[model samples]
Target chain A: ENRNNVDSNFKNYLINLKNLLFIYLYQFLISLKIVFSSFIHRLIALCHPEKSIKNQIVLITGSGGYLGRHLALEFAKRNAILVLWDVNEDANRQTVEQLKSQGFFKIYPFKVDLTDQKAIKSTAERIRLTLGHVSVVLMVAAASFKAKSILDTNFEQDIEMHFKISYLSQLWLIQEFLQPMINKNWGHFLTVSSNSALIDMPLISSYASFKLAQTKLIETLREELIFNGIDGVKTTIAYPSILKG
Target chain B: ENRNNVDSNFKNYLINLKNLLFIYLYQFLISLKIVFSSFIHRLIALCHPEKSIKNQIVLITGSGGYLGRHLALEFAKRNAILVLWDVNEDANRQTVEQLKSQGFFKIYPFKVDLTDQKAIKSTAERIRLTLGHVSVVLMVAAASFKAKSILDTNFEQDIEMHFKISYLSQLWLIQEFLQPMINKNWGHFLTVSSNSALIDMPLISSYASFKLAQTKLIETLREELIFNGIDGVKTTIAYPSILKG
Candidate 1:
């Protein structure tokens, strides 16, 4: 009787193992299908140039910065109306001048610090009133990177400043601007993240941490938008490596 | 002459293609080797349980929380000294009492609001004076999760509070404690992150963003430690899914 019991138990175990193997294989195939379909969709999009930005209202934060200025010019070339925001008034004005010199007249420049929530809300309100509706927002604002050992950094000043600018500012701006996009159900949100988001490194803990936060925020926003059936609202996170200015 | 020019160009293209293929194959082999080695190392570690925590000084932040309290019990069983920090004094005391009841003696508890940098600094100083150098820092402190839509959230109060607690607190504690660990060259840093860091969803943008930042900070610190030749300083990031309280 004991031998019979052991034999039955062993047979049951083998059957359970077979069931588990089948379940895993089924799940693996499903995952592969999803990946393959997504890859094909991406390939198609890459081959077909979609000039969707033509005549769209494009808002660029940190428009005074190097990449931001060039992005502004590109949007202008694509015939998109440009709304440029920067903390530095003089530098922003210089960008405005440069755009005007290139015969891009539909450019508006605003000097606004993104870290202040109240300021962001007020400026966003003004932009909505002035420029019909913002169809695309390029979040390019970043605190200047500082190389400091974690020990050498001040908690409230250095670390908090980076968090406020890189992470919190993105939230505030998205909160202020996302409503109109949701209402329209057609908008593009692009965030410029750093390669540090993927590859961990030393000496820029504050910068890397905040950038990772920003990247994750964009991803969450994307998923939320899609899940809510707001598929027209697209999100892109660009992780660029170090740029030599 | 045109035919001859085309022929030479085609030959050059074929040679360049061969060189490109060689370069790609070399890089692919290198990457494969790295992946294989790391997989083997992980498999070995998984098979052999290393009791590294025995007799080590282990600090648990937010020790009143579900996971934190349990972790304390585990460390206590492992014969490690325990230092617990929490914003909730009553809950933290309860954890300590439970440990004591279980015959775990070397346990200390402190009430700390992690948002206040000054308070953190002072308390860390006190811990140093009392507990000696903390060998393993388990950064598990998290602001209580709140489900608020991005539109419904207050930028300054809700979002900023989460950022302060989740991100800045980690930075401050690491700053305060990292030097001693570096000096000893034998320490472990473990951060408790969330599944939200990988799979983004709605209603917890603030929490997810900060948690992602915290996760990235741990990773970067790990890399930095290794690069700086402090291999004794180990790091682990734990990403637990939803837990029933």
Candidate 2:
């Protein structure tokens, strides 16, 4: 009986050791596969030359805002035709003036409310009639941030506003432009989502939720585009950290 | 020159080998840490006994729907008081009847339009006045899924309905009940999010986006509760596979 017990104990020890080794090996291979695939993806992305946007009609929403103004300037420098949309008339005109002063003459400024779907559709139609089809859309507009917890935030006033700006506006714009982009077989969507969408923070529940929704919208759009084999139309989502502006 | 070239090549080879070793070690350590932590968490959860909900007031939205009816049966079996909310009056009454036939008398059915804020508020108030404070909320309500791609989906009708049912209703319900839950220091929030939220799927963009938003809301709520040192209130989000219901 003592001999049999010793043999069984030895067999169990070997089995446990073998199982532990197998588990570690499986984990190591998974890690290796992940690392290798990511490395290859980065390498491929680096190999692709930057696409030129010269003379392309680039529609930028929230052109009155700080990031929008900067993006407009950059696109202008690249010789792309800028169609700037902003609800604030003064700020929109100021952006147009700033671009004109810099000798960027292909700037079209439209004072449009993103929250109003009718205004967005009409303005988009007008742009298409006048300026040709827009090939790129930069969604940079976001509702102003207010530091309030979920309990303190009002649903209709605060949360709805965020939902409109961060989510609904993007939805409407994408709906307006995506069909044309697919027909043309070349377009780009640059969605400016915030870091709040990816992280947990205090007192920004409404902002974070809608921002996350925006990210999901863009993500699903990309997936659908890919599923349809529309490779020419690309979507990029930027999750920028908190900015001073 | 030959000796110098050989020495340089050898040095470069050694450096590359060192970097490769470092990278593998770092990845391995990360994987190990993740595995160890999850194992410990599972062990801790297993050691803790399940909490009893006998005679507790449990509010379940969408009680007229398939999952809701089944949940109603389960909770009734557990001897918990069920407050069922559904826009379909007949279906809600049927759920109550089913429970009653099963010898569960503590069932309350309310015909409330989740899309209407006023109805939800008033109905919630009535529940509070008549049935004491609800200790558990099961958010299982969702808009019916239509397999239409983003372009085919209408913003006002289809998307808005999904947003109202999936995201807004949860927001309103949580707002109504959370403060009371905090006061009681014993509450549980169970959110039934769909698998679409986590996976990339075509033709369900609207449903997926709002479901993701629902998840974010619950996550942020839990974080906020933790930040406030309110550990008694618990939040759990479920990402179930596609259910026929």
- DockQ, per-model, please? 0.21, 0.19
Q: List the residue pairs that clash in candidate 1.
A: none
TM-score of chain A of each: 0.80, 0.81
List, residue by residue over B112-199, the lDDT tens digit for candidate 2: 8889989989999998898889999999888887888778778776778978888888888888999988987899999999766766
Q: What's the CA error at residue A77 for candidate 1, in Å?
A: 1.1
- Candidate 2 Cα outliers beyond 4 Å, as residue runs: A1-44, B1-44
Tell how far residue B10 is off in model 2, in angstroms. Answer: 55
Task: Show where candidate 1 strays beyond 4 Å.
Answer: A1-44, B1-42, B47-49
Report the lDDT tens digits of candidate 1 across residue range B202-237: 668888888988887777676566545565778888
What total of clashing residue pairs does each candidate reach?
A: 0, 0
Native-referenced Cα lDDT, model 2: 0.85
Q: Each model's TM-score, in the order given? A: 0.80, 0.81
Quality of candidate 1 docking, DockQ: 0.21
Candidate 2 residue B65 Cα shift, in angstroms, is: 1.7
